[model samples]
Target chain A: MTTTTAPVRRPTDESQVSVGIAMVFLLLMAGYFLLPIYWLVVNATKSQRDLVTTNGFWFGEFQLGQNLADLFARDDGVFLRWALNSLLYAGLGAGIGTVLAAMAGYGIAKFDFRGRELLFGFALGGVLVPATALALPLFLMFAGVGLTNTFWSVFLPSIVSPFGVYLSRVYSATIPEEVLEAARVDGAGELRIFFTISVRILTPALVTVFLFQFVAVWNNFLLPLVMLQDSTLYPLTYGLFSWQSQVSRYPELQTLTIVGSLVSVIPLIITFLGLQRFWRAGLTAGSGK
Target chain B: MTQLWRRRTLAALAVAPLVALAACGGASTEPADGAAPGSADCAPTGGPVNLSFTSWVPGVEEAVTLWNQQNPDIQVKVNDVPAGNAGTYSNLFNQLKAGTAPDLSQVEYDSLSSFRLQNGLVDIAACEGVTDAQAKFVDWTWSQVQLGDDGVYAVPQDTGPMALYYRKDLFDAAGIAPPTTWDEYYQAAKTLAAADPAVKITHFPQQDANWFTGLLWQNQANLFDISGDQLSVTVDSPESRQVAEYWQKMIDEQLVATNLQGFSPDLYAAWNSGTVATWVSAAWGYSTIRDNAPDTSGKWAVAPMPQWTAGAKNAGNWGGSTTAVFAGTEHPAEAAKFALWLNTDPASLEILNKEGGLYPASSDAQSLPALSTGVEYYGGEQIFDVFKAASGEVDTDFTWGPTMTDTYRFLSDGFTAALNGQGTLTDALTAAQTQSVDSLKAQGITVGG
Candidate 1:
């Protein structure tokens, strides 16, 4: 491969025009996705009255503090509880789902046990089933044991991500078998070798799995909706929807819905950005020669 | 003849068989077939009684806090529930299925029969202060809890007596006095439309089956007659068609706006912009307009609904709810006690009205600070006086069927079709009548062929 860059060229008019056109298209694509977030942030700063009267895309007043106070303080601080519940479900759910997926994927990749391929096929099949389809069955199963409306009802079902396992197994191929052999020869136990050597090799895959599972759990609507009868037990999605559905009866909820939606989104954005380095790293994980 | 049958059945039926046929509906009139609705004795347990209540009313916690403060031993926990249609009823049904139902739940008047048919409600009549407090509520409200059986299944929480909420300024500017009869209302509607087509005298609420039912209720046009095990569906009667045709004429003549459904954003926008001139709504709907159209405050006034005949004293009702002790509750006595105080106590009634925007079922609410005052939102009109009168005028004979939810859907679809220029309102009622009877029979309710 040539180390020298292609002879440095000044920007010709034609090349500049092409780059400019692509830049415009890229900027437009970014704006398309970010417009709602921008609208949400702008509207979150407005009072309930300003929400209807003012321009939706522009700022109305500096009332984010008051809005938060109102949103959190309304319904006896249930919104804050819902936010915390979202974080708990997503954080713990993703952490556990990723670890389980990593172990199962690593086992299937490194070992030749019977039913290993069958189990891999099952995990791949699990990825095909939408979460909505399982919500009702999960609800009935949870209800059978007097577990519905409990934290475990929503949490128990969320911690099994077959896609995460599939990704982990696929990524596990990147870890050389010689690395595991050397670790075994050095007197490291299987668990220790997987925890230290294999986990390091699977970091990118683990992070991908965690991000996918975290977002899924955080934005999950159907499971919590069916399992939870209590509003206090609701995640952010369900909680916001409850407020939204009542907007006709209580118009002030319109503001809270917007503000609550904005607040709920902050954690997701932070989660994605905080782990974007690893997420990006996973995108190029097996592409290396 | 049907009333005679009901009187006899209430006294003769056994409680055990009723529980077996609960989903087919009898409003389980005694302790259920389980540990729930506990013992029959109305005596309070000497031990600490913890009861859970679920309600859709806003600011319910304030009343619960007061109840908790006064009786620390009988602590009542308030569960936040959305409005009935929003999921409260579904949650209650889920709880009933799981055998984990809350001690008390908010059941709407129209839905009471449906719940009763499912055997979801417990007979609280035997509970202390239940029967004695019957006289405190309006007569119609008292009958709602009874469900044609001798048992008081619930305490009536709120009543939504119908009244005319009109734009006082617009009426005055147009020299149109509030109509006192349906004929006069028709004239006034024409006058408003002729003067300005943009400003309608009222919007026909096509999606609001409850409101239309209220109009029927005022004319003594009840859609159901439950006699023993036999149900008579009367939704397509002369009384219903008379009311339907009058509204149909309004639609054909373009005297009123159409397509504004129940509590939609478009309806609120119309109210705020003064495009809608009058809303024939219930007493509890005061906040709906006040909160949604804050800018249009002090421009409204309340009046009694236009009569069917001149000098007649008939009024409709729209929405009301009861606090029912669930069939699965372990503390029926405690639940009944809380229900009584929540609905009958003056302070609790006042708080419920002021904070939750509820119109109390108790006659004592007529004297509450919330009702007695001249509301600033309605140009200092003693608006509730109209409702208080309307409440008294509601026909005690009017009854809800066991399949009101399905009936509502059928009628709403019909009304939507009628409004869209497909058929007349009378046609809608006739179609709804057949469908309602079919649904009743499908639910194991015996309907007259």
Candidate 2:
């Protein structure tokens, strides 16, 4: 956490009691957040019987290697297929979503368009409606065009994140008017200027948008649940849900669900670790000179 | 039926009930060909056929894979949907509305009438060998697929005839024998409770309205009687009251665990810890006990359900499902063939049973070599023998209505209230009866009040 950069002890400025309380509060919050994942990782490595009988926070008889092997080998590696589907949906959706967001956000912030506020207001309205509330209506809309079970049904909806646009518009204020006018006068076309000069200045903030969109699509359940009927097209979340539901008939899937969940989150972790510097920079950019 | 275990929640989605009505009035009856076999045309679409089948059964794809190998031209793709009454029904409804539903889908027997009402399933009885295959399935299951010789909408896949699953170690330790009648069962409950404060004879889970429906079935409490469009709804009646009052006595005496929910981790742990003794469940429940409480292997055994009258044999049923070929499929004949083989073929049946714990509804499969053998978990007891006997005693005339999802939800709500001390179990039945009749009427099905 970024808390590590902050000194807990400030002998001249703060008392030890406040420092102690702050440290304890931060530790408790971390433990609360990490405990469920820790339980999943620990249980995923255990046999089915051990899952219920043994301590949830500790290891059991090591089935970690076996569990991973069985998970991948299941249904001729269908879990891997789901993983690849998730990657495609999230990675490409986030890439395209970020570019679109940057253009819209920069246009709204920098240009004096007639309906700029009205367009931004619509985006705010989109943010107010939960994705779950939209899934059914979205499903009906897609079904109208014979696109319900297709990849584009999920991918198209994933690329239209209003929150991503909102974040970008707020961050576009960081780009200077002088730099853009200089590029414009130098005969760089508007599209070229937006892509080259404006987009580069908005890089860190756009990374923040990309990460948010990526995780939302990666963990999306209801959209895929409503939109897709084919298991071959399922994302990691829906695939694990289907397996978990069948645990009564096939008890082996209980552990597999646990292990699959643990495995599904690895890419999210990697993405976060790789891009957190850009994300953190975005968070602090508007705060200071 | 609780046969799917932890099934029958809330209600299904807003299904397009008029789709089937439109199909009748629409000019899409052009597929009839190659001479009418019985009721349906039994026609196959021209050219090589590829079929899609959707099911929630574990390892069903492997069975389809087996079928695909032998009939290379008539390939079946298995779509892994969740259990029926969950998202699968809604998914099927969505696909049906979109006209992109699979050639076949798995539907529970209880919900088959609803699907029939919605006209989701195709009439495939006229398909080659389908009429001849009727004699191969058990009497009740065969009836489940047909609608008064008009057509057969599906093939019988599995049955869930009710029986008793008890912990033999706990029973023997308490100096109690397995109960054979309701009176004896009550006596055993008192004995078990007195012997140890920690244990009860069994648990009567409030959420399991499907299980309760099975109990009512044993008493010959038929919920619906359809004549033309008229449906006689009697979920609350003398026979149902007899069964409810009997369980109400146990709940009053605290002989059953009302705190437990069926198919929950708490129920599994209760069985493992010997806090719960017997489970009056279906033939498929044998696997449920074995799989969940793995540490309690060899302590469990199965027997016929306790009778209502002395020396009388009667059985109720819980969960079972059918593989229905959906309408609008271009290849009905090939889909019907795949559905038939998946259920009745000995090799495919074995795969389904071993991998998914499905008790075959096929009469000949009842005597399969694998079924006749002893299972190691039950201390080498030939458990299927008990199931076979129970299967024979299950009343073939116990009919389900088209809006069972709504009826089950109302019953479950009432049952939950009754269990929590708001009403008697008998009152829950009365409420369920009124609500069920209303539900049927609302669905445009005529109901006798």
- Which candidate should be chosen as best, given lDDT against the real structure? 2
Candidate 1 residue-wise lDDT, A1-289, digit = tens? 1112212353456666666676788899999998988988999998866665456779877899988889989878999899889888989988998999999998898889999999999999999988866765565567789898789999988899999999999889878988889889999999999998899878888998999999999989877766776778889998888778766556778878888999898899898899998867866764774
Clashing pairs in 1: B25-B117
Clashes by residue pair, model 2:
B3-B319
DockQ of each: 0.25, 0.45
Distance (Å) between predicted and true CA of B150, model 1?
A: 1.0
What is the C-alpha interface RMSD of model 1?
A: 6.3
The TM-score values for the models, in the order shown, are 0.88, 0.91
Report, for every candidate in turn, its global Cα lDDT versus the true structure: 0.81, 0.82
Positional deviation of A43 in candidate 2, in angstroms?
A: 0.9
Best by DockQ: 2
Instruction: Residues B1-449, candidate 1: write the lDDT tens digits.
Output: 33432332222122111122233243222223543353366666668999988887878889889999999889988777557766556556545655667889888898887666666888888888899998899999999888876878889998889999999888888899999998988988878777778988888977789899999999989899866655689999999999999999989988788967767767777887888899998987887788777668899998899998899999999888999988877678888999999998887887888777788899878778768879888888899899999999988878887667678888989999999999999999999999987766654556774
What is the docking quality class of candidate 1? acceptable
